[model samples]
Target chain A: MPFQPGCRRLMLQIDILLSALANGLMTGAVYALIALGLTLVYGVLHVINFAHGATLTAAMFAVWAAHDGLGIDPYVAILILTPLFFALGYALQRFVIGPASHGSDSNILLVTLGLSIVIENALLAAFRSDTRSIDVPYGFSVIELGNLFLPLPKVIAFFASFLVAALLWGLMAHTDIGKAIRAVSREKTGAALSGIPVEHVYAVTFGLGAACLAVAACLLMPTFLVNPRVGNAFVLVAFTIVVLGGMGSVPGALIGGLIIGVVESLSGLYFGESLGQIGIFLIFILVLLVRPAGLFGARA
Target chain B: MTGSARLPILIAVIVLALLPLGATSNTLLNFMTFALIVALAAQGWNLLGGYGGQFSFGHAAFFGTGAYAMGLLQVRFGLNPWAAMPVAMLLGAAVGWAIGFLAFRARLRGAYFALVTLAFAEVFRILANAWAFTGAAAGLLVPLKLQAANMQFEDKRLFYWLVLAFVAGALVLTAELARSRFGARLVALRENEDAARALGVDTLRVKLAAITLSAGVTAAAGGLYAQKSLYLDAAIAYGPWISVDALLAPIVGGLGTVFGPLIGALALLGLGELSKMALGNLFGGAVPGIDLIVFGILLILAVAFAPRGLLGLFDRLIRRPRPAEGGEATP
Candidate 1:
C-alpha cells in the first residue's frame, strides 16, 4: 500500500492500460461504422451482405485513387465518393441484389459472397498486391495526457466516427425517409401495405448502408494500409461485432464494436497480439451462448 | 430419376480412373492427382452443404487434424502411413464430432453457423501453430518412402492411381448415401426443417452422421495429401483456401447432385491454374492480384447468372434439345 518500486510499476501499468483502452475505443468506432451498414441491411432485408467489407475496401481504394491518381484530398474524396457510393448501392440493390432476394435468405448470402470475391479480385487485379495508404498531412502527430499517449489522427478518426454515427441516428430517427426505412426494416409487408414504396425503401436503405462506409474508409485511411485483401480482416471483425451488438440493432452495433475494440486492445496489451483475436472470438462465442439476441438488440 | 442414368457417370469415372496409366508427363500426373484429391474433398463437403443443408466453412480443421495426425505419428513414432492413415481418419472424426456437437447442439444455422465453423478452424490453426510438437507454421513434414503401402511413390502414375481409387470410392459412397433412408431424412430436413422435425425426424442425429462421415472422408483425403506431398503444414493443411475450395466446388458444380463436386473441382482448378498462368507475372513482371480479380469476376458472373452452377447450365443445354418439360431444369 505504501509507495515503492512495485507501486511505480503498477502506476506505469495503469497508464499503459488507459492508453490501450483509448486506442481500442477509437478502432471500435470504425468497427461500429462499418458494421452499422451491414446490420441495417440485414435488419431490413434479412440478408448478411458479405460484400459490406468489400464496399469499405472499394471506398478506401476510391479515396486512395482520388488522392494519388487524381490529386484530391481524402476529405474532398468523401464528398465526391459519397454520392457515387450511394448511387452504386442504389443501382446494385435495385438490379443485382433485388433479383437475388427471392424470399430465400440464402440467395442473398450466396450472391453477396460471390460479389465479395469479385470485388476483392477485381481490386487485386487493378491495384496489384501492393499495400497503399494516404499521406495524411498530420499523420504522425500525437497528443499526450499525463502518461497516456494518443495519436492525433486516431483521435480525429474517432470524433469523425461519432459525428457520422450521430448523423445517421438523427436521420433514421427524425426524417421522413428515415421513418420509411425504419418501417421497412421492421416489416416489409406492413410497410408496403401502408403505401410506402418498399422497393424504393430498399434502395435507399442500401444507399444509406453504403454511405456508412464513406465515413469508415476515411477514418481508416490515416492509420491503416489499404490493399485488395484488406477487407478480409474487417469482414470477420464486423460480423463478430454485429453478432455481439445484436443483429440489426444499431445501438447494439455501436456498443458491441466498442466492447470488442476495448477487449481486443487490452488483450493485446496484457496478453499477446495473437491472443487478442482469441479473446474477441471467445467474446463472440460467449455472447452467442448467453444472449443470442445480442447486448443491445431487441428480441425478434 | 432412376439409377440408370448413373451408367454414363460410372463410365466417366472408369476413364478417369485409368487416365494415369498412359500418361507420361509428370506435371500432368501431378495436376490430375491434385484435382482428384480436391474433388474428393469437395464431395465430402457436399454431404453437409448440399445434402445435409449444413454449410461448413471449417471442414479444413478436420483435414488439418487428419494431416497433422499422420505427420506427427510418423515423425514421432516412426509409424507407417498405412497405420497412421486410419488413425488420422479416427482423429478427424473425433474432432468433427466434438465441433459438430458444440455447433449443431446450438442450432446455429446459415451464415451464423458458417462463421462459427470458420472460427473453429482458426482456433485449430492457432493451436497447431503454437504447439511445437506439430511444427507450427513451418509445417510438419513426413519422411519420404518408396513403397506402395507406405503411400510413398517414385512414379507419379502410382500417386495418380491412389488418388483415383480414393476419389472413386468417395463418389460411390456418396451415391450410396443418397439412396439410404437416412439420406432421405437429410433431404427432407434440408428441404423443410420444421416439417421434417414434425414428421419424427431426428435432425440432430442426421446432421451428426453427415458431419462425421464428411469429416472422415475429408480426413482421408488429407492423409493422402500428406503422403503425396511428403509434407503437411498448417498453411497447406488447415488453410482458409481449403474452406473456400470446399464451398466453391459444391456451389459451382451443382448442389446435392452426384457429379456436381467433381465437375466443380475440375472447372475451378482449371480456372485457378489458368489465372495463375495469365496473371502470375502479366505486368512488367507477373502481378499477384490478377488471378484473384479473374476469379472474383467469374464467381460474380456465375452467381448472378448461373447460381445453380455449371451442371445447371449443362442440363439446360441438354434439355433444350428435348421439348420444354415446363422448364423444370431452370434454377
Candidate 2:
C-alpha cells in the first residue's frame, strides 16, 4: 500500500516477465524430453529421425485412448504406455528401418521420412485427425504467486522432466546397455568387433528414444491436446534444442530446452504468437552456421 | 533406347504430346498438367539431390520464392506471366545460391543441410504469411484471364500442351547436363567430396552451381504452378508438401536418371489412383490418408529394392551386372 505508483508499475512488468519465463521453462522441459529422444536416436543411427514427431503424436494418441477408451488416468497411462512404445520403437528400427535402409546414410534419411509419412497418415486414418484433450480435475487449477498463475499440470511436467532426465542420465552413465549404446554410437565397427551386439544395441537405443516420447506424451497430454499433427508444433522446437545442445548431448538438450523456451516465451510476448516462430528458426540457423557443434556436442 | 537419353525422352514426350488427341476429358487434362508441374519440381530436386548428391529437404524455399514472385509480379505489377516466370526463376536461383554459400561455407552436410533448408523454407513461409504485400493469409489470387498471352488458356488442353512443352524442355536439358563435363564433376563430388577436392575439383563451386540451377528449375515449376492455379497461399507456396513431392518423384522413378522425375511423377500419380481405388474401401471410402500411406510404403520399398529406381531396374534386367573394376559408374 505504501509503494510508489511508478515503482509498482515496474514491479508488475517484472512479474509478467517472470511469469512468461516460468511458462517457457515448463514448455521447454517437455521440449527437452522430446529432443532427448531425437538426440539419442541420432547418436547411434547417424541420421535425423523424421519419425520422431509422429511417434510422439502416436504416443499421445495412445495416452488419449487409455484415458477415453479404457478409462485410465493420463498419469497412470504413462506407466503402461512407455514400455509398450519402447517395443514399438524397437521393432520399427530393427524390422523396418534397419533392414530397409541397408546402412546407407541417404537411404536411412528416406526411410525415416517415409516412416513419418506413414505414421502421421496412420494416425490420421485411425483417429480421423480431430484434436482431443483429457478433462483432468485440476486442468484449470493453478498455483498463484503474487499476480502470476502457473498451471498445475505444467508445473508437474517441469519437475517430471528433471526426474526423467536424471533417470536417463543414470541409465546412460551406469548401465551396461547404455554403455553398449554409447559404444555403438561412437563406432559401430569397433563396437561390433568388441563383442557388442550392434543391431540389438541399435534397437535398444531406438526403444529408449521412443520410451522418452511416451513419457513426454503422457506428461504433455494433461496440459497439451492430441491430434494427428500436434507433435509437429513441438518437433521443430525440439530439433532446434537438439542442435543447440549439441546433437547427442543429453544435458545440452535439457539446458537448451530451457533457453529456447524462455526465448520463445519472450518473443511471443513481444511479437505476438504466430510471428514469434521466426525467433526460434533464426536462433537455429545462427547456431547451425556459427557454432554447429552446438554447446555440448563433440566436434565432428 | 540403349545409348541415347534423347531417344527415350523424345519418345516419352511424343506419347505425352499425342494424349490430347485421344482423351478429351478435362479432369485428365488437369491431372496431366499437375503431374508435369510436379515432374518439373522433381527434376529440380534431381539436379542437386540425385546428380549432385546434396539432399535438400526444404526445397519449398525456392519453390515458394518463385511462386511468390510470379504471384506478386502478375497480380501487383500487372506483368506478363512469361516475363514474371523468368524473374521468379532468377529470384529462386538467388535464394538457392545464398543458402548454398552459407551452408556450404560452414561445411554442413547430410542431416544438417537437410534441416537448415527446412528451416529456411519455414522462415520464408512465416514472412509470407505476415506480409500484406504478399496478400498475407487471405492469399494472392491471379485474375482469371483466359487469353493465351496470359499463359492461361480457355481450352484446358492448351494448358496441358504448354506444360508438356516445358517438361519436355526440362527433360532434354537434364539429359544434356548428365553427359556434360560439369555433370561429371557433380558426380565426382557426390561420390567422394574429399577425394574430389583432393583431385582439384572446386567442390564448393560445383555445389553452388548445382543448387542454383536446381532452384531455378524448381522455381520455374513454381511459376508454372501459380499461372495454372491462378492463386497462391502461404501453405500452397511454401509448405513442406511441395518439398516432399519435389524429392519423392525423383527418388521413386530413378535418382540419377534424366527421365526419372517425369517417369516417377507419372508412376506416383498412377500409384495414388491405384491405391485410392484399391484401399479406399479398406479405410472406409474417401479418406485422404490412404494414398499417402501407399506413397510412404512405396518410398521405403523403392529405397530398399530399387535404389536407382525404375530406369536402373530396367538397366539391370536388360544387361548383366557390370564387373566392378572396369565398368563405368554412371547411373
- Kindly report the docking quality category of candidate 1: medium
Q: Which candidate leads the pack in TM-score?
A: 2
Candidate 2 residues B1-331, lDDT tens each? 1247888888989999999889988888888899999999999999999999899999999999999999999889989998998899999999999999999999999989998999999999999999999999999989997998988888888888888888888888888888888988999999899999999999999999999999999999999999899899999999988898888999999997888998899999888877887877775687767778888888999998888788778888999987772322342
Range of the 10 consecutive residues with the lowest summed lDDT in candidate 2 chain A = A1-10
* TM per candidate: 0.93, 0.97
Overall lDDT per candidate, in order of appearance: 0.81, 0.90
Give the per-residue Cα lDDT of candidate 2 at A204: 89
Query: Model 2, residue B273: displacement in angstroms?
Result: 2.5
Q: How accurate is candidate 1 locally (lDDT)?
A: 0.81
Per-residue lDDT of A99-148 in model 2, one digit per residue for the tens? Answer: 99878888888898999999899888878878899988988899997788
For residues A1-300, what per-residue lDDT tens digits would candidate 1 score against the true structure?
567989999998888889999999999988988988989998888778878989999999998988899988777777888888988988888888777545457767767776787788778767877899988787788998887789987888788888888998999889999999889887888999999999888888889889888778877887889998888778778888998888998888899889878988989988897777778777766666556667777764
CAPRI tier of model 2: medium
- lDDT at B75 for candidate 2? 88
How big is the RMSD of model 1?
2.6
Model 1 achieves a DockQ score of 0.50
Q: Model 2: runs farther than 4 Å from truth?
A: A1-3, B1-3, B281-284, B320-331
